[model samples]
Target: MAWAILFLAGLCEVAWAVGLKFSEGFTKLLPSVFTVGFMLLSFWLLGLALRNLPLGTAYGVWVGIGAIGTAIAGIYLFDEPATLLKSVSLLLIVAGIAGLKLSSH
Candidate 1:
């Protein structure tokens, strides 16, 4: 299904985002390669999903997923601050993504 592909793409977005931290400005060879690979795969999946999903809905959901996932990764992996406001904001993004999916045909 297109939604499933889109969801996978969103997950890839998260992987690549975390990969960037590991890549260290692309100075690390293995991590940089994996990051680039994930980036390409994520875009490719998005393209496939676009065949059936609306651009606005797909893009918004993809971005929301990446944002939320990366933020969580940062909090857990990098000791990034996890304030109350940040948590609430992430929840809001999740709600928006759910609303978008429900509203889409």
Candidate 2:
């Protein structure tokens, strides 16, 4: 399904984002390779999803997934503060994503 593909693409976006952090400006060979590979795969999946899904909804959901995943990963992996404000903001993002999905019907 296009939705599944789009969600997978969003996960790949999160992978590439983490890879980029480990890449250290692309100086790290393995991380750089991982980042590049995932980047390509993410875009490829996104393009496939675009065949049937509306661009605004697909892109919005994709971005929302990446944003939420990256923020959580940053907190756990990089010791970023998980403050109440930040947590609430993330919840709001999730709510918006949910609203978008629900309204698409």
Candidate 3:
């Protein structure tokens, strides 16, 4: 359950990250508001998950999820480069997140 909440938080992190691009330095009103909202929700969910999960594992996984999701969003939405090295790096992050989960509990 904690892991599930942590995953949701990570997804919110991704939403806020992409939201930043849409917000345009917070100049856009609606996007900026959504961004701030997601940021708060992400933090709140993370706090809840922390009650049961180890800090190191939960934080690492959360960051890994955000990084991967944002990178994918950038590639798809923003026409960001999707080089081989970047793909491999994302895979490495996934591996690290998995390792942390396996090492925990």
Candidate 4:
């Protein structure tokens, strides 16, 4: 349940990040509004997850998901650099998150 909320929080993070890009320095009203909404939801979901999950582990996983998912989405959707080194680093982040989850159990 906590993990599920964390995952949703991560997904919201991704949405808000991409929304930021479309916000056009906050000039674009719709995207900026959506971005703010998503950001709020992200934080709310994170708080819910923290109710059950340890702070360090949950925060780490939440950040890991946001970082990696956003990077991948940026590269694939926005044609940001998809360099080999960056891919490997993302893989390492995922591994670390998996390690934390396994060890928590």
Candidate 5:
């Protein structure tokens, strides 16, 4: 359950990140509002998960998920480069996250 909440928090992290881009320097009202809303929600859930999870592992996993999700979203939404190197790097991040998860027990 904690992992599930953490994963959703990670998704919210992605939401706010993309929201930051769409918010257009906070000039756009709706996206800006959403960006701020999701940011708080993300932090709330992260804090909840941290109560039960190890600080280093939870924070690293949260960041790893956010980084990978945002990079993928950027590729599709912003036409960012989709080079082989980028793909390999993302896989490495996933591997690290998995390693952390497996070692957490």
Candidate 6:
């Protein structure tokens, strides 16, 4: 199903994001390779999802989900900024994604 593929793509997005952090400016071999693979897989699934979902809606949701997911991972796993302001911003992104899904129906 397209939804399942999209969800997988989102997970890959998260993986690649963590990969990027470990990439050490792409000098690290394993993480760099994994990052490339995950990035390719994520985009491929996004393209497949776009075959049925509207481009504007699908792209927006895909990007929003990836951004929010990656930001949360960065904060919790990487000790990046986790301020209340960042939390509010992430919630806003989630709210927007929810709104998009609701309006699509």
Best by lDDT: 3
Whose TM-score is higher: candidate 3's or candidate 5's? 3
> Which parts of model 5 have CA positions greater than 4 angstroms off?
none
For candidate 4, write residues 10-103 as lDDT tens digits: 9999999999999988899999999999999999999999999898899899999999989988998899999999999999999999998887
Name the Cα RMSD for model 1: 0.6
lDDT of 1 by residue, 1-105 (tens): 999999999999999999999999999999999999999999999999999999999999999999999999999999999999999999999999999999996
lDDT of 6 by residue, 1-105 (tens): 776777677778888988999998899999999999999999999999888777777887888878988998998888997999999999999999888777777
Query: How would you encode candidate 3's per-residue C-alpha lDDT over 67-88 as one tens digit per residue?
Result: 9999999999999999999999
The candidate scoring highest on TM-score is 3
Q: Indicate the worst ten consecutive residues by lDDT in candidate 3.
A: 96-105
Query: How do all the candidates rank in terms of TM-score, highest first?
Result: 3, 5, 1, 2, 4, 6
Clashes of each: 0, 0, 0, 0, 0, 0
Q: What is the Cα-based lDDT of residue 56 in candidate 6?
A: 77
TM-score versus the correct structure, for each prediction: 0.97, 0.96, 0.99, 0.96, 0.98, 0.93
The clash number for model 3 is 0
lDDT (Cα, 0-100) at 69 in candidate 2: 93
- The lDDT ranking, best first, is 3, 1, 5, 2, 4, 6
| Candidate 6 lDDT trough over 10 residues, lowest sum | 1-10
Of the two candidates 1 and 5, the one with more favorable lDDT, higher being better, is: 1
lDDT of 1 at 62: 94
- Backbone clash total, candidate 4: 0
Better of 1 and 6 by TM-score: 1
- State residue 5's C-alpha deviation in candidate 6, in Å: 1.8
State in Å the error of residue 78, model 6.
1.0
For candidate 2, the per-residue lDDT at 61 reads 90
State candidate 2's TM-score: 0.96
